[model samples]
Target: MPEPIPSFAALGSHPLHPMLIHFPVAALLGLVASDLGYVLSGDPFWARAGLWLAGVGAFGGWLASGLGLIDLIAVRRIRCLMTAWCHAVLAMMMLSLASLNWLQRYLAAEPILPWGLYLSLLTALLILLTAWLGSRLVYEHAVGVEAKE
Candidate 1:
């Protein structure tokens, strides 16, 4: 068997990228639900929730991606994998969408209907795709897995 590729952006033994990804994933996905809640109930509360979620998701995603980028750049084995490149590209695309979504909500006082919802949905989809590619790196290629001695 091939040796596992350890995470260069790790904190001690734990991989920082994986550890930090859950928050952004949950927050970004929740933005869709919050937007839907605003649509269904016509409450400004949901819209406000969406704004917070978007900001948190976009910021947190970038933070995690930064660590992952470090690992991808610093480790030759990770850099050589096509899955790594795909994951990186998709992650960047997703982050861009997320940032745009946040910016729109931040700058606009109008309702978050139509366009915001669309952006949220697109960002969520990209997040899923990026996550799948990232999972393949960890599960299939063992990109951040450490072998037991």
Candidate 2:
């Protein structure tokens, strides 16, 4: 079996992935709500808010993914390696979607574009699946968690 990852990537023995994940998760999920608000109220504020949230969420996702990469390397020998790859791929996809959403919003002349709103809603669904895979990595597969002595 491969050796475990060093403790540096963790926070006092806890996984960094879990700790840093909240920001992107919240930001991305919040995007759907904000987009919904724009859709229902036709308010530009919600669109602007969604744009900012998308940027923040994409950035935060990459940051978290960097730490997750470390964990992935550490757990390469585990049986759930394929699941990890799926998680990583979906995460990067989610980030790409969010980044593109932000770009569309930033470049558009209109207050809110229908395609951008629809894309964000799709991104929200991807976030849900990606988050579920992350949870599976920790709970079912014990990817980043240290074994109990």
Best by lDDT: 1
For model 1 the local lDDT of residue 84 reads 97
lDDT of each: 0.93, 0.78
lDDT, residue 127, candidate 2: 88
RMSD in order of candidates: 0.9, 3.0
- The best candidate in terms of TM-score: 1
In terms of lDDT, the poorest run of 10 residues in model 1 is 107-116
Model 2 over residues 45-127: C-alpha lDDT tens digits? 89889888888888898898888877776654543478778998998888898888878888888635677777788888998
lDDT of 1 by residue, 1-149 (tens): 46799999998878999999999999999999999999999999999999999999999999999999999999999999999999999999999989999999999986488889999999999988999998899888988898988
lDDT of 1 at 79: 93
Q: What ranges in model 2 sit over 4 Å off?
A: 1-8, 78-80
All candidates: TM-score: 0.97, 0.86
